[model samples]
Target: MIQTEIYNNGPVEVAYQVYDDFYHYKSGVYYHVYGDKPSGHAVKIIGWGTENKVDYWLVANSWSTTFGENGFFKIRRGTNECEIEENVVAGLPKSSGNIIGGFIAFLALIFYYMF
Candidate 1:
């Protein structure tokens, strides 16, 4: 789960318009605008970065990398643009059969020592 501020300007509706639908032309850092409103939209936070000593957050978009900064975009850090800074959640990685088997073996050894 992710959080961001209200898209009063409606990001999904405005991003294309702002970039003019030009692929490979939208490459740059992004910033957040602070205010009271929630658009109920979600975007994945890919990474973090800093330019010229300024902080920012990296966002991943469905549009191909050619569309925007290698399929990613930067937004203002710490401001929670569109409430992005709030209520974030990530899932644990899936375990493979081999890993589970190894864990089970380790547990068995521990049990043997205790008994």
Candidate 2:
């Protein structure tokens, strides 16, 4: 479902459970298999592709470019890896044939999350 949304829409916001190993993440496909007491974290999955026979979701993290793969990382796709597939949210601006309307829609989404 997340993949489908990305294919049709664009980036999708996803809330994930972060474990201890996530802090050490630097490069390559991230697949957390162990650790306990995961904290909540959110990231945007902009796209997906296969790498070295491994399917992954191209995710953009908020930790800045100094973090994983220039602030982006690939995580094992499918199988609900780290429950990332769950709690997916996506929205499309209602096309009112005007730029202001579109911008308002975008702002509304931000406000929805803020409040």
What lDDT does the true structure give each of the candidates?
Answer: 0.48, 0.81
Tens-digit lDDT string for candidate 2 (31-64):
9957883576778999999999999999999999
Where model 1 places Cα greater than 4 Å from the true spot, the runs are 1-25, 32-40, 93-115
Clash count, one per candidate: 16, 0
lDDT leader: 2
TM-score of 1: 0.47
Model 2 residue 49 CA deviation in Å:
0.8
Worst 10 residues of 2 by lDDT: 106-115
Clashing pairs in 2: none
List where candidate 2 sits over 4 angstroms from the true fold.
95-115
lDDT at 23, model 1: 30
TM-score each candidate. 0.47, 0.77
